[model samples]
Target: DTAVSQTPKYLVTQMGNDKSIKCEQNLGHDTMYWYKQDSKKFLKIMFSYNNKELIINETVPNRFSPKSPDKAHLNLHINSLELGDSAVYFCASSQLKGTDLYEQYFGPGTRLTVT
Candidate 1:
């Protein structure tokens, strides 16, 4: 079974439109994160949820928000999308183990194209 899954692998929307991406993890991970990858493929953490609580809210735009209904699900909603928001958004989940602290399973990624 896939550990992490995201809906709408490819998203195409116009600027100023609001969109959302849903993510679910079946791995029973305590931590889940949303990341944005720019055109340069540089990944930056956006929001993180640990055990249904907001843990890390990085330096992201105010238009973006993350919502977690439970430990196994995290969703990202973007408002007033801009061309700059055109990039790949990734959802990842992990269980913190002393040895594999940074180990995470990522979804295939949602490609957002704003025009």
Candidate 2:
């Protein structure tokens, strides 16, 4: 079984379109995250959810939203998509085992292209 999975691996749309990507994890981890990989291959954390409460990174825009319906699922919604928003979105799950140790497992990623 896949530890983490994302649906609609590829998305192609025009600017101003709204889209959502769904992610599911079977690893039983309490913390899940959404990351965006830019054209320069810089991966940045957009949001983090621990037990369904959101902890969004300050740099992320309000147009991006992350929802975790449960511990095993995290979904990302983007409103009024822009060309600069085109990037690979990754879903990850990590467990806080001890004081400050965490091992994150990432999904394949969903590539979104906006025209």
Candidate 3:
């Protein structure tokens, strides 16, 4: 079974469009997160949820929102897409906080291109 998966690995569209990227994990993890990797390859956490509870990281934009229907699935919804939104989005999961390494297993990234 796939530990993590995302749909529409490549998305291209003009500015001001709304798009959503879906994600799912089967590792039985309680915590899931959405990360944005900019062109410079800097990984930034956009949002996280543990047991369907939202945990906001202050640095992220309010335009982005994450919805977790259950512990196994977390989805990202982006509004009014902009050129600055072009980047690779990665979905990841970990068993819980304070675990050793707590290494995030990432899915094949969804690349969003806004023109």
Please name the candidate that would achieve the greatest TM-score relative to the true structure. 1
Local distance difference test, each candidate: 0.93, 0.91, 0.89
lDDT of 3 by residue, 41-101 (tens): 9998888898999875547667888899999999999999999999999999987758632
How close to the true structure is residue 42 of candidate 3, measured as C-alpha lDDT? 100
TM-score against native, each model: 0.95, 0.94, 0.93
TM-score head-to-head 1 vs 2, winner:
1
- Candidate 1 worst ten-residue window by lDDT: 95-104
- lDDT score, candidate 3: 0.89
Candidate ranking (TM-score, best to worst): 1, 2, 3
Tell me the spans in candidate 1 whose CA falls farther than 4 Å from its real position: none
lDDT of 1 by residue, 86-114 (tens): 99999999886675548988999999999
RMSD of 1: 1.0
Candidate 3 has its poorest 10 consecutive residues by lDDT at: 95-104
> What is the model-wide C-alpha lDDT for candidate 2?
0.91
